[model samples]
Target: MIFLAIRYLIERKRQTLLTFLGVFLGTMAYVAVSGFFLGFHVFIVEQLVNNAAQIHIQARKDYLSAHQLDQAFYENSYRHVFWYFPPSGNLGYLEVQDPQSWYERLARDPRVEAYSPLLTTAALFSLSKISVSAVLIGCNPIQQQKVTSIADYVVDGHFRDLAVGGNRVILGDELMKRLGVGINQTVRVSVGTGNASPFKVVGRYYTGNRFADSQAYAAINDVQRLNGTPNQVNEIGVRLKDYRQAAAIATNWSRIAPERTESWDQQNANILSVFRIQDALRFSMIATVVIVAGFGIYNVLNMTVNQKRQDIAILRSMGYDTFDVVMLFFSQGLILGVLGGACGLFAGYFFCRYLQTIPFMPAAPGNPQGYLHISLDSAIYIQAALVALISSSLASILPARAAGRLTPIDIIRAGG
Candidate 1:
């Protein structure tokens, strides 16, 4: 039956080629689009994961109530206090409760790969007469490097230089450019209108992200002193054994620690929402292509069945069962599917390779002349082939079943 179907398809060369082309194009389009979108997804995720900690723990907040205000008023009553307007206060430190305890817990949790305590403060970076406001992040370079990929993005100087605590700072590449300073240059850094101290430029990193670039890092002790908060850390950044387990771990950790804990995904929920939409769009586009290809397969097979009515009738009368008749036409669709899928896979692979060679710079400042990312994930190809095959099989079924039910008497009467 398979041989007969192949011979029949071969005889109608134009129809067979056209059907094959439809499936071929559909499969190739699916693979190419999947590679591009999925590849971009991987790149975005890598940036998020590397630039941001999977789990971020920050100082817990406190609020002043009317009772506290009443108490303060009573205490200061002797001082002739009238209407009260209390001053704003800073949040308490995560380390204030117990730094050693947190570290011990982090160490005991085998899932924790690395963690870093941070003290972030706002600072004005001035070079001679030019000054720009920038975020100053204080971290233990040795620990920070382990927690995040800040070390990997370093283009100049060493992250470890910050550990020396010589008022040295590592600036982001964009920040360095804005300050108009280079390696070994001196810049005065003042924490939020505090005393300005000259910092020797020890290192620079380029994350290609503007926000990340608009930051500088110094030793944790330097930042603590600058912030006037000794023996305090406001934040703890953590990387886990499996980053995907971040949300769950963060939720549980927040319950144990007196700090606000958030996973990278939780922090960037809006971005993940956009990703879900993109995924839907990607799949919908491929499905549309495959469905159109299915219709093309149906049209061709429908016509083939109509034209081969006599053949069906004769075969049925000559001892071929109804199952054999169905198998014959079904095999034709399978053959087209196999041939088209094979060709499409090869074409898609080459197209994706070509796409990978093309350069694309992000609209935001970062790596210029970066090659386009293309994921040749095997699953994409497998999915492409499966969709093609399933579409072909379904489109062939109606015509195959109709051919199987054809009667020799009806064919003879129609001929007569």
Candidate 2:
């Protein structure tokens, strides 16, 4: 019966081949589209993790000004030999007194890890004898170095240079490029305190993140001296020994330091929300492609059954059961699915590799990075194949059922 089925399929080779091609192309489209979307989403996640700390803490109840408006706490000493404790502050709550002592006590918890107190004051920079306003960052170099990539972010000179009392500063490559300033060039910073102050440009750095790289870094004490707020810092950047503990640490800090602490998720809520929305959109697109491809499979299988009606009837007369004929046709669908799925896997991998060589693409709105890297996973292939199989089988089902219902007498009458 199998030999007869093969011969029947061979006699109608053009129709059979066309049917297989249709199914194969549809499967390929579905797999390729799904793979691209999945790969794109993984790329965005990786870029986000690389650009910013997995977990960030800031003052709650403060919107855009969480980093600047809150009265954060600070500790005079490092919590541990490795940890440099920063100040803490409240946003909605009345400024708490003795926050320094409060943070110190909290640091004693075993769950606590390395943390740094920080303050951020938005200021503008103007090169001496030049007219350009650039953003200025005033942070504790000692602690900022431990938390942010400012230390490793440096391209020339050291972050420690900003720690000195002499109004020294570090500039980003982009900022310097715009200002036409180089290392050792003098630049004046007008921080809206009273008057513009002068600081010597001593170093340059790049963080790869466009926003971070488009600013200047100054000493925390220099900002303090200008603001006339002694021993006051605005922000604290915390680093956990185990990043996986971020949620736990956030919950602990929220319980202990209520109304003050905010995690990175909360800090960057707008951007994170955008990521989520884009993820949904990508998934929807992939699903739509798969559904359309499933329809193509249905069309192909329907044609196959029509072209082989006589053959199916003859097989039934030769003692081959309806179940056997159904299985035989279903095998064709399975073969097309397997072959197409394999082709799609290779196509997706090479397509991603080709994308990398091109310039960075503009991602969802507010995502400043121009390009992203695609991530490939083994599970994606499995998912692609599974989808292909299900679609193919479903497409073949109606045709198989139609042929199964055929009577030998009806077929013989039609031949007469």
Candidate 3:
């Protein structure tokens, strides 16, 4: 029966080849588009993951509203009012007190790979005549490196320079250029209180984010003193053993601690929203191509069944069962599917490789050459084959059934 199906398809080689080409292009399109989009997404996510801490733990806050927003206010009468305000009379909670306790808890948890206590404060940097207002981050250099890839972006000096004694500071490369200063140069840095204190320039890092690049880093002790709080560290940066669990762990830990916790994903929610839209577009395009390819298979097989009615009837007359007739015609679609799917998978693999070779010229932070990312996920090839074969099989079914129902007697009567 298979031999006969091969012969039938060979007789109409044009139709068979056209239908095969359709399925091949469809399958190849699916793999190529998915690889490009998904690969790009992974690239973006990688940048986000590496440039910043996976989880940021900060002091929590409670807000209060008055009579105009009274619907949100409810209080009992035991020396209590309709609204409760902060006891400290600050805008909100500014600092996380006794961070050593949290550090102890984090140290005990095996999931916590590393954590750094950071004190962030606004400051002014002045060197020669150039002065700029910038945010200053004070952190333990060794621990901060574990949480973020800032150390890797050092273009001119060492990340360890921030650890050096005598109020040394590391600024971004862009900021360094703006300051018109080189290594070991003294710059005046002043926080909210007191007169400007001179700090030595130790290192420079280039992260490609102009704003982040404009910031400076120093030892936690220096920043703490600059912020007028000796032992107050407002932020904690944590790297995890399994970063995939960052968002969930952040939520759980935030509730247990006196701070607000945020994961990289939660911090970049808008970017993920754009990714979701791109995904929808990618799948929709692949689905449309596959459906069109299925139509090509349907047309070819339907035409073949009409042309081979006499053959089908003669086989039925010679005691060939209905199942045999159906299988013979269905085999054509199966053959096209198998061959096209294989070739398409191979073609798509090469296409993705070609894409990777092209230089990506974007000014991404850590990426030097900025090459495009293409995901070589095994599932892409597997799914491409399944989509091609399943659609082709479904297209063949109706025509195969019609061919099977043709009776020899009916054909003879019609001929007569």
Candidate 4:
């Protein structure tokens, strides 16, 4: 039966080749598209993961409710004292009240790999005659390096240079460009009408993010002095042993701790949503192509069954059972699927390699020349092969069944 199926397919070479092409192209397309989108998705996710801390803890602020306000102001002297507008906003400086306690707690927790206490301040940086407004983040160099990938991005000097702590600063590439300053140059930094303090630029880093590149880093003590809030930290960045557990840990910390805690994904939910949309689009596009390919297979096999009705009837007269006839035609579909899918895998691999060679740069400042991130993951090829085999098998079923049900007597009567 298998030998007969092979002979039948070989006789109609043109239709068979066209059907094979359809399955081949469909599988190849699926592999290539999946590789491209999934590669990019992984790249973005890695950036989000490594560029910053897994969890952020902000300074705590307490607000008074209306009932509490009434109790404090009226002292229960009057029954009702309603105002046109309710009171709002917290009272106190925006500095963490007890950062030392948090430091001790995080150090003792096994889940926390490292944590950095930061005092962020908006300041004006001036060099010679140029001035730029950027954020100045104060951190301990060693702890900051452990909490984020800042050390990897340092281009001019070592990140540990700031640890000298004598008013040293590390400027971002873009921020240094804006101020027209270089390493070892002195820059004047001032916060909120205070006296401008001179900080020597010791290093420079480039993160490829425009906003991030427009920032600077300094020692925590220097920043506190410059901002006129000595020994105060406004935020704490925490890196977890297992980043995937960040959300749950952050939620638990927020409920128990005075400071506000948020996971990395929670901070960048918008970007994650865009990734989800890209996934849906990638699958839908490949699905459409595969469905079209399936139709091509169905048409070719259906035509073959019609044209070979006499041969099928002759086999039936020779006592070929319905099951045997069905198996013969089904074998043709299986052969096409297996061969086409194999060829498609090779083609897809070469195509992905070609894609990687094409030069492309993301729309980010300070980014170096690079190619597209195309992933040749094994799962992509496996999925492509499965799609091809299943679609082809399903397409062949109806025609195979139709051929099986055809009676030798019916064909003879029609011929007469």
Candidate 5:
């Protein structure tokens, strides 16, 4: 019976092709759209993970201006004392003075594997060759490896080269490309409103993310010397020996350094919101595609039933049962959907691969990476196939029921 049904569908070449086309379009739309969003989301999350560790600690909300243990120790006792004194106030906006050895205390805690002090300050970068205003980041290479994966992001040069070059700095790949710079090129970088000094470009790094790849990095002391910001950092990246300890660590930070520490998730609330919005948009788009396919299938099957009334009647007169007649039309729709879905799957995969190859940049609201990486996984393929099949089955329902309802005598007389 299935073979006979297949033969019947093959005989109606035009109808078969049209039905297949409908399913094909639906499947392709689903796969391509979903693949793009999935790749885009993964890219953003991965970049975040690379730049900042899973947990970040920042100054908490405090009525007092200082993040110190207490204002009294520094204000009265250490105010006039220059030697072995705390860092200056204005340049120490984000600095944490561990007079009480807070960092050392946290280091000994089993939950914390590593931590890197982060310095963020906007400074006028007046390189000897070319002067450009850029943000400067300072990090310790040894401790940074424990927190951020900066070492892995170097595309062209080594991180240790910055140390070797002394006054040298690392430039982001895209920024370096914009500056038309090469390794060993000397550029002057100054922090705050200070005059710039020549700093050689010791290395270049690329993280496959435009934002991170646009910033420049120098030693922590260099940033402090230029900006007059001493013994202070904007943020601290904390990597747990085990991620499950993150909540416990966060709780500890809150108890110890209340109003001054935040988890990475808390810090990245805005980006996480963006991901949620994108996910919702993707779902709506997929729903629209499935609905459109279902409607097309419904229309096609209804028209086919009207045109095949005589044939249906003839089959009923020749002893075909209602169940058999229903099965025949169901098989037709199923075949069309499955074949179309197969074609769509191939087309979508190639289309996504092509997207990866083309050097095209999306507009301002989109990422500046200029490439979309699509994931062609079994889950995506299965989703595409199911959309086609369900749409096809739904469309054939009315027609199948109509055929089954026809009595042999009434159908034959009506056909005549």
Candidate 6:
């Protein structure tokens, strides 16, 4: 049966080759495309995880409800009172009420690897003549380094320079360019209507994020003094022992603490949603190609069954049972699937390697030549091979069954 199957496939070399190519290309496409998209997804996720805090705890603000507002304004005399315009915004200050308690709690928790208290404020940064408005983040330099990869992103000087803390600051690369200043330069920083204070730029960082690159960092005490809110902290950045456990831990923390806690995944839900969309698109495209390949296999096999009716009749008369006939035709599909899938997997791997060698540019400063991120995960190749085998096997089923049902009488009746 196997010998006859091989002979039959060899007789229609052109058709067999075309059908094999369809399956091969489909599998290769699945592997290559999935590798590129999934690799990009991993890259973005790693950047987010490393560049920022895994869990963020911010000061909680309580707002007055409509009923509370009415009670406050009318002393509950008029229960049905309506206002011409609604009152909005929270009533409390933005500073966290207790920083020491949070610090102690975070230190005691085994899940927390490190935490940094931050005092952030919008400030005007001025050089000799140029002035730009950007966010100023104050943190303990050593603690901040433990909580995030900020130290690693420092392109010039050192992030530890802020540890000296006598009005020292680190500017993002974009901010440095905008202000036309370099390391060790003096910049005037002012919050609101306060008097501008001179801060020496000690280092520069480039995060590849435009918004983040437009910000500046200073010591927590310095930021508090500059903002006129001494010993106050507005945000706490938490680093977890295991970053993937952040969302669950953050949810539990929010339930117990008055501070609003959020994980990095929650904060960047929009970007993650886009990754999901990419996944859906990747599978959809691969499915379409596989289906086309399936159809090609079906077409070729159906034609082969029709053209080889006399052979089927001769074999049936020679005591080859219906099951044997089915196996004969089915084996051809199995061979094609095995051969095509193997070739495709190898081709896909080579293609991915080629892609990684291509010259590309990264958005991050200081890195001039970069290459594409292509993840050659073993799962991708396994899935592609499965798709090829399943598609070809399914496509062969109908024709195999049709060939098995043919009898000697039926062939003689057809005058062949």
Query: Of the candidates shown, which would achieve the greatest lDDT relative to the real structure?
Result: 6
Question: Per-residue lDDT for 1-416 in model 5, tens only?
Answer: 67866876777677677767777877887788888878777766655655677677664434333334344566766445443453344332345645236677666887778887777777565544665666788877668766877877666667766555367688888778767778887777766465767778878887666877788888776776777777777667788777545655676777765335666656677887887887797677667656776666566666666667777877888899999988887777777777888899899888888877765655222344566667676788888888778777887778778868877677567763
What clash count goes with each model?
A: 1, 13, 0, 0, 8, 0
- Candidate 5's displacement at residue 301, Å, is 3.0
Query: Which clashing pairs does model 3 show?
Result: none
Q: Which RMSD values do the candidates have, in order?
A: 4.6, 9.9, 3.5, 3.0, 8.3, 2.3
Stretches off by above 4 angstroms in model 3 are: 66-91, 363-366, 414-416
RMSD of 6: 2.3
lDDT, residue 76, candidate 4 = 63
- The reply for model 2, stretches above 4 Å from the true place, is 1-40, 53-55, 59-114, 124-127, 130-135, 140-146, 150-153, 160-166, 177-179, 188-198, 207-211, 240-252, 284-289, 361-372, 405-416
Give Cα-based local distance difference scores for all models: 0.85, 0.63, 0.84, 0.87, 0.71, 0.89
- How many backbone clashes can be found in candidate 3? 0
Residue 334 local lDDT, model 3:
84
Tens digit per residue, CA lDDT, model 6, 157-261: 999989998999999999999999988889999998679999999999988788999999999999999998999999999999999999999999899778888
Judged by whole-model lDDT over C-alpha atoms, candidate 4 comes out at: 0.87
Q: Where does candidate 4 stray beyond 4 Å?
A: 61-88, 91-93, 362-367
Best by TM-score: 6
lDDT of 2 at 350: 72
Q: C-alpha displacement of 328 in model 6, angstroms?
A: 1.4
Ranking by TM-score: 6, 3, 4, 1, 2, 5
- lDDT at 60, model 4: 69
Residues 1-416, model 1: lDDT tens digits? 77899898988899888889988888888889899889988888877887778888887777654344554548756355444665455445434366677888899999999999898888999998899999999998999998888888887878888998978899998898898999999999897656888899999888777888999999999888877888788788899989999999999988987888899989988887887887897789678766876787788788889999988888988999989999999888888888888898899999999998887755322445688889999999999888888888988899889888888888898891
